[model samples]
Target: MNLVRSELLKIRTTSTWWWLAIAAFLSIALAFAFNAWVANETLNGNAEELGVTGDQASAAAQAANLYTSGQYLGLMFVMLIGILMVTNEFFHQTATTTFLATPRRTSVILSKLVAASLLGIGFWLVTTLIDLAAGAVFLSANGHGTLLGEWAVQRALLLNLLAYAIWTVLGIGIGTLITNQLGAVITAAVLYLVGTQVVGLLFMLLSNLLNSEAVVKWQVIWPAIASTVMVSEGQTDFTPAWWVGALVLIGYAVVSGVAGVLITRRRDIS
Candidate 1:
C-alpha cells in the first residue's frame, strides 16, 4: 500500500499528469464532436454517402464508437504516463532511493503496475462521463433512440477501461527497457503515432497483394489494432471476436511487464 501510494504521489506531484490530462480532455471533446456528427449523419439518412446502412447494427456500432471515443488519444496518454512513472524515477535520481527503501525490486515494479492501472481507470472514468453526456445529448437531438440500453454499447465502455490500463503497463515496460526519459517517450510516441499508421498501410497492402481479406484477421497481432479490436462492436463480417483482441493485448502487456521486472532485477542503475 505504501509503495502504491508513493507511486501515486509521484504522479500527483508532477505537472506531466495534468498536462496530459488536458490534452486528453481536448482530444475527447474533438472526438465526440466528430463522432456525434457521423452518428447524426448516419441517423439522418446520410448513410449511403457515408457507407453506412443506417440500421440498428450501424447505429449501435456508432454509439459504441462514440461512447468510447476518447480511447484513441486516451490510451496514448496513459502509456506515456506509465513510461514516465518509471523513467521519471531515473531521470530525477529518485530511483536509487526508491530501490534503497524497497530493496525488493519486484515489489516496486508491482506497485508501479498497480498505480498505473489506477491512473488508467481514472482516465477511463473521466472520458466515459464526458462521452455519455455528449452521446445522450446528440442522440436526443437527432431523435434517435439511446443505445445505452444495449449490451454491446455497455461492453465497449467496460472494455475501454481495460485498454487504458493495459497500455500503461506497456508504457512501464518501455520505460524499464529504456531509462532515458526523453528517448523512451520519443520512441513510444513515434511508435504509437506513426507506427500504427504504417502498420495499417502494411496490412492494407498485404490484403491487396494476397487478393484476399483473410489477411485482415491478423491485424490484431499488432498491439494498437488489438486495442481497437478489443473495443469495436464489429468491423466487416470477418472481424475477430472481442475476446481474441483482449487476449492478444493482455499477452503484450504481460510480456512487457514481465520483461521489465526481469531486466530491472539485473540491470545496473548507476
Candidate 2:
C-alpha cells in the first residue's frame, strides 16, 4: 500500500509527467488540425486530382485519418514518461532505499514498469479522444463526412489507441534497461528516430539494388513501423505484418525488461 501510494505521489509531484501529457496533447491536436485542413482542401478539389471522391464519406474518412495520425510525434511523449520514471529513481538515489525496503526486486521494477506504461497510455488515450471529438466536429462542419454512424472511423481510432499502448510498453522496457535518465532518453530517441529508420532505409535501398527479398524484411527490426497502423487503410507500402511488428516490439520490451531485472537483482544498491 505504501509503495503504491509513494509511486502515485511521485508521479503527481513531478513535472515530467505533466510535460509528457502536454506533448501528447499537442502532437495529436496538431496532427488532427493539419490533416483536417488538408482533407478539407482535397475534398474541395476534383476527385481525379487527389484520387478520391469528393464526398461526405471521403471527408469522414479523411477526418478519421487525421485523428489516428501522429504516432511518430506522440512516441516522444511515451519515451519521455518511460525513461524518466525508471531513470529518475537512479538520479535521485532512491533505488537504494526502494530496493532495501522492497527486497523483492522484480516487484519493484514491475511496479515502475506498470506505472510508466499506464501513465503513457492514459495520456495517449486522452489525446486520441480529443482528436476524435475535434475531428468529428471539423468533418461535420466541412460537410466532408458524418460524425456519427461511421464504424470504420471508430475502428481506426481504437487501433490508434492500441498502437500507442504498444509503443508505450516498448518505451517502458527500454527505460528499465537504461536506468539512467539521459542515457535512456538518448537510447530511446536513437532507436526510434535514428537507428531503426536509418537501418530500414539502408536495407530497402540495398534490397532494391540486389533484388534480395531478405533485405525487405527489415520492417520487423522495430515496432516503429506499426505506428502507421492507425492510418493508411486497405494496406500500405512494404512493411512487416501487423502481428509480426507487434511481436518484434514486444520482444524488444521483454528483452530490455529481463535485462533490467537481472541487473537489479545483481547490483548492490548501497
Candidate 3:
C-alpha cells in the first residue's frame, strides 16, 4: 500500500502528468474537429461522394466513431504516460532510492503497475468526457443531434475506456522491459504508430498472395481490430470474437509484464 501510494505521489509531483493532460485535451479537440468535418460533409449531401453513406453516416455510427476517436488517435500519448511513469524513475536515477525504500522488487513493480493502470483509467475518463462534450456541440450544430444516449455509442465508449486501460498496462510493461527512457518511448511510438499498421498491411498483402483466409484471421492485427469492432459492432469480415481480442491483449500485457519483472529481479540496480 505504501509503495503504491509512493508511486502515485511521484506522478502527482511531476510535470509530466500535467503535460499529458494538456496533450489529451488537445487530442480530444482534434477528434471533435475531425468528427465535425464528417458531420458537416454528411449534412451537405457530400457524404455519399466521400464514401460515408448509408449506415456509415448514421447517428449511432457517427457517435461511436467520435467517442472512440480519442482512443484511436490519442492512444500513443496515453501509452507514453504509462511508459514514462516508470522510465522517468530510471532516467533520474531515482529507482535506487525507490528500491531502497521498498526492498522487494516485486512489490515495487506491482505498485507501478497499479499506478499506471489508474493513470490509464483517469486519462480515458477525462478524454471521454471531453469527446462527449465536444462531440455533442459539433454534432448538434451540424443537425446530427447528440447521440450519446444510443446503445452503440455507449458500448463503444465503454470499450474504448477498457482499451485505453489495457494499453496503459502494456506501456508499463514496455517501460519496465526497456529501462532506457528515450529508447522505450521511441520503440513504443514506432510500434503503435507505424509498426502495427505496417505489419497488418504486410499480412494482408501476404494473405492476398497466398490466398489464405486463415492467415488474415489469425494475424496480430486481427485481435486489435476485433477488440474495437466488437465494441463498436462495426461491420467487418475479418475480426475475431470480442473475447478472443481481450485475451490477445491480455496476453501481451502478461508476457511483457512477466518478462519485465523477471529482468528487474535479476538485474543489478546500480
Candidates in order have lDDT scores of: 0.87, 0.67, 0.74
Worst 10 residues of 3 by lDDT: 233-242
Models 1 onward score TM values of: 0.95, 0.81, 0.85
Error of 2 at 197 (Å): 3.9
Give each prediction's root-mean-square deviation over alpha carbons.
Answer: 1.7, 3.7, 2.9
lDDT of 3 by residue, 1-270 (tens): 778788889889989889878877877777777876776776677878867755556778777777666565566776788789889888999989888977889888888888877888888888877778777877788677898878878877877777777777778888888889999999888777686677678878888998876676565443345445545544433455445666776677688678767877887897
Q: Which candidate model has the greater lDDT, 1 or 2?
A: 1
Give me the displacement of residue 55 in model 2, in angstroms.
Answer: 16
Encode model 2's per-residue lDDT on 6-92: one tens digit a residue: 665788898877777777677776777777766776777654565544232265566667677666678767766666766778899
Better of 1 and 3 by lDDT: 1
Tens-digit lDDT track for model 1 on 10-123?
899989999999999999988888888777787667867876542334777788888987788889999999999999988999888889999999999999999999999999
The alpha-carbon deviation from the true structure for residue 201 of candidate 3, after best TM-score superposition, in angstroms, is: 2.1
- Where model 1 places Cα greater than 4 Å from the true spot, the runs are 53-57
